[model samples]
Target: MSVNRRSILRTTAQLATLTAAGGLLTGCGQEAATGGGAAASEHPAHPSPTPGAPTVLTPNRIPAATPSAAVSGAPSAESAGASPSAPEQPPLAANTPAEVISGPSDRPQVALTFHGQGDPRLATALLTAAEQHGAKVTVLVVGSWLDQQPQMARRILDGGHELGNHTLNHLDISSLSADQAYAEIAGCADRIKALTGSIGRWFRPSAAQFATARVKAQARKAGYEHCLSYGLDPRDYADPGAEVIQRRMLGSIKPGSIVALHMGHQGTVDALPAVLEALQQRGLSAVTASQLCS
Candidate 1:
């Protein structure tokens, strides 16, 4: 299905039900597969980065805070309440810059980013293809999707890629009030932190595809320095044939471009090999968004 704003909003309720149901199914499958017991340690906590070692900064080139520190800065769910126009407070003083449209133009690299809330198999396929081609891409995951398949976060991180937030339920932040907006951003950040020991490196507003000033501020408050937007969108969510997707992406790509693709679509999975090959032919390497920006 095409995932334009109107369609996303229209299907929001249905998607919520699907996500919840999927989570239950996933939990059951895990129990059965693991002999009906939770592993003693599923995801081990990531150790603190060694001092003087290079850290992965947000696209704005700002250092990210520890997950605990970031969560502390965000408004608590209880504080968010039910009001729409809750007074906006400035995020913590340590908040990073707001948005990053594209990375530095001087490099012969581009970032391929996927917005995922679909089949985990397709995500694995996409990641496998990138790895085969000596590439790494960014994945901005939906919180509910992660709730369904928490292991996907570890898969992304373990593959030496990056992950970020795409909100809890793919809501259009533009239509939401400040308090509600903070919940969406922070809610997803909380999920990422639980799995990966920190919120993923970037935040991208869902459904609307671009962040409003208020939304950006909320995201910053949630500890994301970069609100990632794309320079190239292949519209893979539309399920255009693989050939069309490959053509549009290759045609639109430039040095430092951030290309937006989607998960759940077989076409995107099919298109990736050619797309990566085309990038090589153009002497442009595909990298994680932070790597492209850095």
Candidate 2:
């Protein structure tokens, strides 16, 4: 359940092999900045500029000065001129503005977000439990995880949960080149569409580590509404005791807040019953991430 720092590094090397073979690596995150298992080497320390590469900032949004030559590689024509072969896309399909759908008055209505590597039974158990409460949770389905457990993903959809893109590999977007970042997100989106005929709306930066403005801009360019965390760090990756998980979640209850949990932990499953019971007591209902946005 808990991968050590050394184990994480070893796993990352294995992941690189999969990537080289054109396989997707999803759901492999390590806590670095916020105990979310964000590996320092996983993402590049500085941003690279590649013309035609997707970037969070642009001349329209930021200053007109061109990105440095070193950061920006050879400019692709698309960066300067439009191509006739390019397909037109809807605004929302590519980039939607971020929103917090708070209602007129305060009530316990919020979305729960989970982060972790893949486990088939864990996904199924979470879906079944959520369905029992008639609640919807948003799952940031990673490409690697999906490739390994497509059946489980179908179950998430069947149970009425929303699927969001968690990236091809769980690399920190802040550390990847603009084009690499685009490929990570776009590749995942492509896989999801091929499998489910649905496009993702929400994107949670790996480990919720949004260190660079460019990464955020790149997300917008890639057509994802950025998902920022609000409260209830259940720290499921750490394998907290069920009692401790329940207490932290109960203490952090708030309307319109997004609770962070992991899909790989049995402790999370063990704590869910109590969490659900408490939510019912407080007159709250968990909705999918998209529903919360709506």
lDDT of each: 0.68, 0.56
The most accurate candidate by TM-score is 1
Whole-structure CA lDDT of model 2: 0.56
lDDT of 2 by residue, 1-294 (tens): 456988998999998888866532222221111111112111233121111223233212221111111111222223323221322222332332453323212656777776524456776787788888878887876554554455544566667787777765566565567665665566555445545555466666663544356656666676765644445566666666799999988887677777777776678888888898788888888886656655
Worst 10 residues of 2 by lDDT: 63-72
What clash count does candidate 2 reach? 14
Model 2 residue 277 CA deviation in Å: 0.7
Candidate 1 has an lDDT of 0.68
- State the lDDT of candidate 1 residue by residue for 72-181, as single tens digits: 22333233331222221223223224577787788899999988656778888989999999998889886656655667777787787888988754555676677666
- Model 1, which residues run further than 4 Å from truth? 1-97
